[model samples]
Target: MSDKKNENGISRREFLTKGALGSFLVAMGGATVGGFALPKPTVSPGPSRRYKLGDPGKFPVGTAMKMDKENIFLFRDVEGFYAITAVCTHLGCIVVRVDDGFACPCHGSRFAPDGHVVEGPAPRGLLWLEVSRTPDGGVMVDADVEVDLGTKLVV
Candidate 1:
């Protein structure tokens, strides 16, 4: 056991190891413990759970969809690919998708279709939720990440 006191003479909070563990989470490959805000899906993922919101058909090319319902934004560019995420690089406000791109309603931070920071009170871009197409052809996004700034999804 180890005890390190803070400047207040109170025991400091335990520090969980950080680093590579933040890059990629083993998708549904391990049992997650508690003490997290956005816990696991309340129900088992079924056909309906494939997409957090309604059908992908609702989103067409060049349309930006805000899943504020899920604290995420889904942007469909002319390329037919969509981007999704919640973690804001600024003060962590869930951004809303607008005409050309995304803008944080919190502090007026704007982002492009590819998650590039166009304007700020925000220091950088939002976190990208690595998404894939399910067997049903719906998008599956993972939002368990905590980003300060400069987060991107390569896939």
Candidate 2:
């Protein structure tokens, strides 16, 4: 009984084969659905990015300074430090800076000043980017997210 033509129209053997094949395809950058085709990945700026965190003076107290359209918050905490992110866990909707920390304009998800998920829809915190200052006074940051960040990331 490793294989059988089930009443669901998909053979048991075929189901296993497709399941394995689909997983492999998905791992290979091609999502293989049972009845649908895999869409091609568009040419994009490769997954490497390094953004400067600027200076602490750039962002004053209370007000959240906007970085990008998605990254629109940088609250100055008691440590004279700041947080940054553009990812929204709830349906991946980009969060915006509200009177508090950040808010997902799409579905009303909210976050604390420390990137903590203050409201539902978003179940996680923002990314705490490890940054540094270069000799030129401009900051040099390594933002490659797919790799481990607990260790020092060389720019």
Model 2: lDDT to the true structure: 0.59
Residue range 119-149, candidate 1, lDDT tens digits: 9877766666645556665656555543333
Clashes of 2: 0
Per-residue C-alpha lDDT of model 2 across residues 1-155, encoded as one tens digit per residue: 75666788788789988999998878766433533453434565575566665554564555446566335334454444334665676777777767777778787788875677888777677666655566666444444442221332222
Best model per TM-score: 2
What are the clash counts of all predictions, listed in order?
0, 0
How do all models score by TM-score? 0.48, 0.51
Error of 2 at 27 (Å): 19
Q: What is the C-alpha lDDT of each candidate?
A: 0.60, 0.59
List pairs with backbone clashes in candidate 1. none
lDDT of 2 at 124: 71
Q: Point out the worst 10-residue segment of candidate 1 by lDDT.
A: 146-155
Query: Which stretches in model 1 have alpha-carbon errors above 4 Å?
Result: 1-58, 98-100, 145-155
